[model samples]
Target: MGNRVFVVGVGMTKFEKPGAREWDYPDMAREAGTKALEDAGIDYRQVEQAYVGYVYGESTSGQRAVYELGLTGIPIVNVNNNCSTGSTALYLATQAVKSGQADCTLALGFEKMQAGSLGTIYDDREQPMMRHLLALAELQEFAMPPAPYMFGAAGKEHMERYGTTEEQFAKIGVKNHKHSLNNPYAQFQDEYTLEEILASKRIYGPLTKLQCSPTSDGSGAVIVASEAFVDKHGLADQAVEIVGQAMVTDMESTFADRSAISLVGADMTRVAARKVYEQAGISATDVDVIELHDCFSTNELLTYEALGLCPEGDGGKLVDAGATTYGGQWVVNPSGGLISKGHPLGATGLAQCSELTWQLRGTADARQVSAAATTSGVALQHNIGLGGAVVVTAYRPANR
Candidate 1:
């Protein structure tokens, strides 16, 4: 791999249906890819590799969108890692540029599930081995199936194991929504409170509907360049470098073996972040803004400890102290996260990259920070795949 890879540009559409009608994959891909190209001040001709992530775009996936940029047979690749699809593409793009395989690469992720159904979730009997295991568990535990709501059970287990409360989970909601209020592209731009969150209808145990990320369909893209390429193109003067990256996969069958809330591959998040920080010679306290994978409100809490932002069981403390807020010492999820910003499956990771790119570039408009801006300020993103596959990354300004 090359010495370094940098994010030259990033783009994302509003985290909602584009018009009166809902959204479709092709349109969103075009919207996001064009925006990224514009932001990078470069033409699609510069992109040598394209990695498009989509969950259910059906026929003609990544290639169709890159074709929007005047197809030049740019070795396009498609990736689908459940919810972590976008991040997977991003990881690959970075590797491509780092390995000298491509000087410039594009990673785009988009989806269109707002129209109605969830598009297409393979329910075939001839699925992976993990499918059979989960099915048997569901048959045994009839009432409480281990689906996306496992996060809720994890929340309950957190409280049971560490005396955390529903109100504390609500605290994370209040903080993130407040941060979202400043993000123009965020879906829900308002401040919520613990009381209000508790008052809302419950989805699973203590998890209210508002606390859960809705099934949002959206699109986002990120452009990466090699350090040599950036220097040649004068892009290093304005780019976000990748300081760290790490991906870990755990046992997919999360039935009786693992604890629901005991931190799934959490050690991986820390290890990855630490590696980047050590390589870049920076610490967690050095980061001024962040985009976290908050598919469930409970996740935000766990990430704090996992990322070493705060001590274990101190997630509530970090949020309550106003540390994760904009004016606070360090900001987390200024983009509203999957909770308020909308989780467009494959697009989530790219969205995080877009947000951090804007932030480090000091182009965040209303949400910009005035901190001791590391010309290469850090932007961390975490994305988890089916059950437990996760990939976390940290980005810095390309120039730096």
Candidate 2:
């Protein structure tokens, strides 16, 4: 690392269902970006560069989004890496500061999506997920609405291979929905019993409507600055250091294994998590809070093992023991995760970043993890996209 990078500020808009709020991408960006700048106690002019992320927008949408903040002519790069778009932008911003390219940079992500399941935008050309779909088809029949079928099959594999039950998976939906009850920004704050989760309309194998993330419209922003900038701006007290971060793409094993678990980028998540832990000079046991990509309840269970929170095939046991919830070993998805918090693809990762930042700063309000429970003061984040990209990040107070 060249210069230590710190997240000086973070902000996000309330995640709402698609069309529930009358706002466009620009409006979302303006709200989140302005709040972040204010939180950092800096002006937009102070940002030397920016990386904006959005999935369903025109080519210059990034420039248009940032124009809502200022017209400084700063370099603006638009990013779209499927579901991981938000963190990909964040990864670039952190690299800019870490490599000494710029003292300060901004990472912003927003999305305005249509309600319902996601589908391919262009039918005339090759779909990005065709290869993964083909790989999955080799094991089981392809089902309608690719997202649920893909993750749901992985859940089925877990059930067959490890004796994981449908009730174990339903527990994740229940926990996340209950967790969302405290998060004012979450799209779905209503709590549900495990019976309620299991009884919801089934979308795929062992997966129900309540277990899947809903389409959402929202934006999130994070301001990253160098150590020097933090001291100069008197932000050291609140700065959260980016101690370790790594991004990994699909590995050969992703396809070679022919397992539904690996087919959904579990290997990518494992590799990325290992790299982040190695970089931070810590182990999985050292982490306190986590905000992972739980686009589906099944994905959340798979991630528990992928992130080394438990041994392979023991994720169900971990869930059964309640090791991942509050009053347990680590509080995973304190923000309700994607399943309940909402999944606006472009903004998901930034929302994770914002939540973890607030947790480390002890400012998450009702959703705050108990200070005693977060004794390690280390927060871990995992965000992955299906076309094959995963970003794992570790954060702690700068003074630590």
Candidate 3:
């Protein structure tokens, strides 16, 4: 690390179904961005650079969103990387601070999706995911959304290989739904029984409607500053340091293996997570809280092995042993995760960063992880975009 960087504040709007609220993307961005600035006790003029993430927007949307904060002449970069867009923005912001290029930087992400599952918007242009789709096509095809089919096939393979059951996957939905009940910002607060989760209308393979993330409209932002900036501003008590982060793209294994698990970018997640662990000088066991990408329930279980949370092919047994929920070995998705918190394309990753920051600050209240509630607090975040990229980050309280 060149210069230590810390997140002094974070904020996000409560996610809602597309068109469920009367707000536009700019409106969401304003609300979330202003809140983060206020939380940091700074004005927009203090921000020297900004990275805004989104997928379904036109050019300069990042500049437009930051204009809501102030018409400061800051450099605003627009980023798009599928589901990992938000974390990509956050990664850039952290780098700006750590490289001593900027004292204060903002990472913002928002999306306003249309109703229903995601679909192609620009058929005329080259699709970024075309190759990933082709790789997916090499496997058994299904008459469903590409996302569900890709991840579902992975789940099917995991079941075939490791004896994982449908119920085992459904249990993740149950646990996350239950966790969402206590999160005010979650899109779905109503808890569901494991039976109900299993009984819900199936989307693909073993995944039900409850297990898949819905299209959502929302925004999330974080304010990162150098340690010198944090201390100068007397923000130590509320600061959270980003210890390590890494981003990786799909390797030849992603397509060469002809495995749905690899095609869906599990290998990318594994590689990025491993790099972050090594850079942070810590292991998965040291993490007290996690906010891994759970765009679908199958991906969550697939990620457990990739992130080294459990032995390969042991994710089902890990859940059965209750090692990934409150009062367990680690509290995963205490903010309800994308399964309940909603996936607003761009906002998802920064929202995860916000949740982990709150956890590290011991301010998550009812959803507080056991480690934060009683002992040292450490957080690990994993975000992925299937065309394909993965970002893994580690965080801890600055005062620690």
Strongest candidate by lDDT: 2
lDDT string for model 2 (1-400, tens) is 5789999989899999999999999999999999999999999999999999998988989999999999999999999998999999999999999999999999999999998999777899999899999999999899989999999999999999999999999999999999999999999999999999999999999999999999999999999999999999999878999989999999999999999999998999999999999999989898989999999999999999999999999999999999989888989999999999999999999999999999998888888887512435999999999888999999988877
In candidate 3, which residue pairs get closer than 3 Å at backbone N, Cα or C atoms, i.e. clash?
Answer: none
Quote each prediction's TM-score.
0.90, 0.99, 0.98
Total clashing residue pairs per candidate?
A: 8, 0, 0
Tens-digit lDDT track for model 3 on 327-391? 79988899999999899999999999999988888788899875863336789999999887899
Residue 123 of model 2: what lDDT?
A: 98
Provide the lowest-lDDT 10-residue window in model 2: 367-376
Quote the positional error of residue 272 for candidate 1 in Å. 3.2
Q: Judged by lDDT against the true structure, how good is candidate 1?
A: 0.76
Cα-based lDDT for every prediction: 0.76, 0.93, 0.91
Q: Give one digit per residue, the lDDT tens place, for model 1 in 1-400.
A: 3568888888888887434345567788888999999888999988999999987666658887667666787788988887888999999999998888889999999876644323335777554435533543343332232333556766766677777778878877877777788887777787877788889887775688778777776789999988788888888766888878877765443444455553344555656667767766777887778788888788778777778788877777776787887678778887788888888888999998888888888888777765525664677777876545678887777656
TM accuracy, model 2: 0.99
The predicted structure with the larger lDDT, 1 or 2, is 2
As for model 3, its CA RMSD to the true structure in angstroms is 1.1
**Alpha carbon lDDT of residue 257, candidate 1?**
40
